[model samples]
Target chain A: MNLSPQQQKIIEIVPQGAPSIVEESLFEVRKKIYPRAVTGLFARWRWGMVIFTQLLFYGLCWVPWNDRQAVLFNIVERKFYLFGLVLWPQDVFYLAILLIISAFSLFLFTAVAGRLWCGFACPQTVYTEVFLWIERVFEGDRGARMKLDSGDMSQVKLLRKGGKVLTWALLAAWTGFTFVGYFTPIHELWGEVWNFRLGPWESFWLCFYSAFTYLNAGHMREQVCKYMCPYARFQGVMFDPDTLVITYDTERGDPRGSRKKGIDPRSEGKGDCVDCQICVQVCPTGIDIRDGLQYECIGCAACIDACDQVMEKMNYPKGLIRYSTENALSQHWGWREILRHVVRPRVLIYMGILSIVVSAFLFGLLTKSSLQVNVIRDRGIMGREVEGGLIENVFRLQVMNVSEHYQFYAVKVEGLPGIKLASDHVIELPAESSRVFTFEVRADPESGKPGSNPISFEIESLLGDAEAHEKATFFIPR
Target chain B: MQKWMWILWPSFIIAGVAEGIFFSLVNPQELYFLGDPVHYSAIATYSIGFLAFWMVCACSSFLTWSLQRPAGEVNARG
Candidate 1:
């Protein structure tokens, strides 16, 4: 083997049996993973998740409640309508709480099961699965895909690739459209799209998001999980010995060698693994679980399903590779023991924090006030002497009815000696609407000191007992 | 390629998160520029704001990565 001086030095620096560093670092070329389709319990569950999430995302914006879109964020109108409840810009507290809830939920989920979200629920994983299904539909399974990629350029290959790409693009476009639909009214958006009248920003976002979906799911594949995702990087810290993760039972499946089916492995002094490499072939990340737990493992358990079939065929007990904790695997513990160990201190702490945030979020949502009010001192004019000997302060009141029913609110002012509203005392507001009312509040000339007097407005719904108390300052000229 | 990704990718993600948090708290209609109300639509505000945020974040990342290079590489370049 002829080697340059630089190559010889690199070989000396690297440990024996490691793949040549030169080959790996030169281009950093990515080998596309052609994950073979596997059918089993986990596969079924994955498909179920794909269907459930896709249906919810694609179909949810079309649902109407109370003659309005049920869950429209409505960025243009600056309102968030969720079922019977309406949230204004001032309700950003709920959004913060929702984000906190999601973070804690992720923590708790990760503590209990290693990468369960990555395996079953992450958008990256789910989209990849959907794209793979489309690929299989158009180009056939792993073997066919590999063959086509390596084979000469042919008419059949081009057609197959074209069909797959077209389908993937359509699905991606729909995904992006549905996402934008959540912010805008879906039906109205459909009308605009059909008329070729999409707003510039809307069109830009639609294209940007569609391209993102195509590149990430179709092209990047495991690269997103292995490199791009921040969650994947930090999730290792949350994992413990008791966390359920995809693992290969090395003690039971060792001295791996190919053997005929139905042959008892004990007779030849071999383990269950037949050196089939089926697990590697089915891996989305192209990792061998028999090498033990790796960060690259998303815990999707396709390897487990693949191994179980191999184990069953070889007249061996299943679960050569399966979902088992580190402690369970090493100690040879049963499911009951594994369950007992899962409630450790780390998991309990995560669970406790998650429950607290979730409950706080729910409580805040349920007890949210039905009416909101903001008092703005009219900037144009200040204290004025009215026809009478009283000092009056001009103000604008922004009142919002956050409920689903129309009601008349009795508005009054107080908090200073004889401070009374000079504007109409009663204002009617439609359901889920806000209005700015300009009103004047008068006070006795000698009320407290002459500079500024504190005042409060009492706006109470006449139909319901809901009330909003807003504070404002009234100025009296010296 | 790897160095470019180290700054660009993470900053891109952070910019998206920043946009979400900022927009949720402050409505575009209420925004003002130089004492005059911003006349752009909500989508335009969000898009421009996101891009502005991405630039700021990417600048910070670029500075950090560039400064933290190995002494050998810096000396070699010089």
Candidate 2:
């Protein structure tokens, strides 16, 4: 780990004047990144996830569910219908728990493998990759694209630019439409769009989201990851020396210099690195892997793929730049030690909590009642005495049928003797709708001390499968 | 200050108006609904009041952004 006198001097001067250097803030503006394509294990894995995720997203909206959209977040109706489960607004806590779980999962993943989500599964990464692929197809590869940008305004350049823009715009618009389809029914939304009958809000959001997609994915690209993303900035906190990151094996690769192919590096006392710059060329964020691990490296493993290819060409062993921890490279720790560190207490706890939360959510969904009853006491009148010497309390019952089919529920009162329904006992609730019914409950005055008597209402479905019980207080005069 | 103000003010107004129109159309009935006609007008008044309040908030944010110094200057201060 010894540094040369010149390197030591450079290191000493770096900190002393770093503040003043940074204060100027006028470094060369980063050129647009044209990440060269590479093929390897991780690259294939990334593409696999991209296809899998996109298929699930696009396919789920079209899946049929009992004469309705398969999964609809009917925000207007304050209900979310997902296959068999109907989630009311009151069940929004589940969504909050889901968000918490996702956040913890991010933390856990980041701690284990630095920025794995950013590199692989993040929507930003996935969409940007797609957009870049399209750009490559229409405009050509990285070198061609760079050349096109530098060229004069010609018919050929215009045609390529025009075609790329049109493609990007269409894809971005479709993405936005698909996003809105999650809230509104996709088929119905398509019909509405086709007929030019899209609502004002729908139109606005469609345009807004489309514009954002175009700007962020198509134009902003790596700048979004490098500068704008809060995750990139704060992710440093989650990183440790043991965390797996895309790193250069400086010990093996350094004193890095250009050499002819098939040359013996050991005899020449030269390092294995041929200084081809393929790793930098393939990097989406326009970073040099040889510069050491920085926040900009998303651990995409493009460098690994690039370096592997270079190593193969040179007849050298691969992994000059690979997914490895500092401990692994520095201390030459084995994969077993790395695995032990990865599955430590923090990750285990996150996994345990996530499992419990997911199980509880599933259990709640499974055992949830399809019929719900909510009682609202008439605010105008408290309580009155009937001609039969029975104390009466007026209540409004909002009965909701969360199921797809019709349900008839028989309302019954408990917690007071001789209490009877003033109206018909049986109430029929339509599918996916609430029914308001005003009914009076009769109880003996001496049943309870009088100011407020605790009462429970039980609504049992005539089908006998689903039942819901709600509690309320009934006021009785002294 | 003027350049930043010009950029921020329009965006603020645009976003505010867009969000307002969006939420309004999404739940028009809920926005207008009141228990009774007498209560309806009262609720409408309150809704208008809140709408104005939000618009002002948006404008004030624009102002705040405009009043702030340039990033280079801010960093120099730090």
Candidate 3:
């Protein structure tokens, strides 16, 4: 067939031996994986974790501490109350430190045991597991779900599917509500729900988070871990030969074939593996463990549980698939031997860094001043010469009461001779709140030289012994 | 930084243009922070929004890369 000049040029640009369109397409269509449920030791641990985490997330908002939510991030009030500790927006460095600590913890954990967080504790895994359980309750097991999806639609199918959707929506919406509750008071949020008067921003966040949770957990499932999760992509960089990962013992399980119930695997000239494929069936990511430790494996150890059960039934030794490091497997080292190598230099370094960060974070929190004073010079007017021959400088002082109780603060100025607070120095600040006050500092023109003299504002709490001193630049006429 | 101008320039232009259009369409006075003298709260708000937006953009970029890959091929890590 004759081709256009543009098409001819495209053909010339094509490399030799490159896969044609028929061989490989650009886009990969997703094939749905229906993971078969299997009961095992790790499965029980996962369920336990699900219960533990969900309890803390859904129930923590209701628990009262000092007549307020136990762990509330009151964004509106710009206060973060974590049990006994109250933090202001100025204390965001603490949050950054918290994030750094979490990152280091992940590094340490991933280096020691691969994807332990992903399998058991990560929100994606936990929520997906819960959503799957909900789906199983409405529908049936793996086989039933597969059949229902492929089969014709019916009343039974409609009811079950509809019921599942409704349940998931309600759960996701409640999750969103609880999430919003951490920022807004849960009781007040509940009142708003009753009155249908939730603020637009709050309502938007609630819906947005709910929809995200539902799509991630209910529909996307493993796709979130496989495609979207950056952690999954980058976690391999943290892995080493000593890192414990889910592995299949290819030396024992290879040369595989099926066998009768009572027949010995050696008699049939085959390895211990009967090739039942149960391990693959139970895998969340639908990868064959026998193919080596792939990044796709979350190291949930469900395959270990499945393979062990198969080994037991066949009167064979267990651990055909288990959590073993590359070095351990290569050296044929057992559990005790593996434990010794876990304390190696890389892990020690991570631990040392983590400890330093943790201690520093704790020290910062412990020594945090209850009274915080931030003085900003009024930009509208720099300085003025008053009738009394005093140089007056206006400033906006933001005084934050970081304690749980109300505080009475008295402001005083220092650094220049005869420098004194020219406005009301005493003010009452509410509990865990900040108020911006316009205050004037006056000093005799002869007392200090012109053009930006350093001054300090001392805030002393009358209600408590807490006090803070913040330094600001005082402008003077040149 | 200069070497990657081909990439950085487009990203910078997109961000700057988008920010301008967005601020104009949604009067920043309606926001909790009125611009001019930037407050700590206003800075914090913008910082968080920038972080969240960048993360979402990163995720979408990854997805686009994934779509461009040949079928049946998997990402291999060394």
TM-scores of the models, in the given order?
0.87, 0.83, 0.77
Candidate 3 lDDT by residue in tens digits, A1-478: 9988877754356576976566543224568878888788899999999999999999999999988898998765656789988766567778778888999999999999999999999999999999999999999888999999999999999999999999999999999999989978999999998899986667777897899899989987887777656688899999999999988988888789898888877777888889999999888888899999887898778899899999999989989998899999889998999999999998999999999999999999888888877888899889998879888889998887778787888888899998998889899988777789999889987887878899899889886569888999888898
Can you give the lDDT of residue A284 in candidate 2? 88
- Give the better candidate number (1 or 3) by TM-score: 1
Predicted candidate 2 versus true structure: per-residue lDDT over A249-303, tens digit per residue = 9999878898877778867788989899989999989999899988888878888
Higher-DockQ candidate among 1 and 2? 1
- Selected candidate, larger TM-score, 2 vs 3: 2
Ranking by TM-score: 1, 2, 3
Could you give candidate 3's per-residue lDDT for residues B1-78 as a string of tens digits? 222322333344345445433432443324653455434443244334544454555555556555755555555421
User: Candidates 1 and 3: which is better by lDDT?
Assistant: 1
Between prediction 1 and prediction 3, the one with superior DockQ is 1
Q: Where does candidate 1 clash, by residue pair?
A: none
TM-score of chain A of each: 0.87, 0.89, 0.83
Better of 2 and 3 by DockQ: 2
DockQ of candidate model 2: 0.11
What local lDDT score does residue A401 receive in model 2, on the 0 to 100 scale? 86
DockQ of each: 0.54, 0.11, 0.06
CA lDDT scores, all candidates in order = 0.88, 0.80, 0.82
Error of 1 at A462 (Å): 2.5
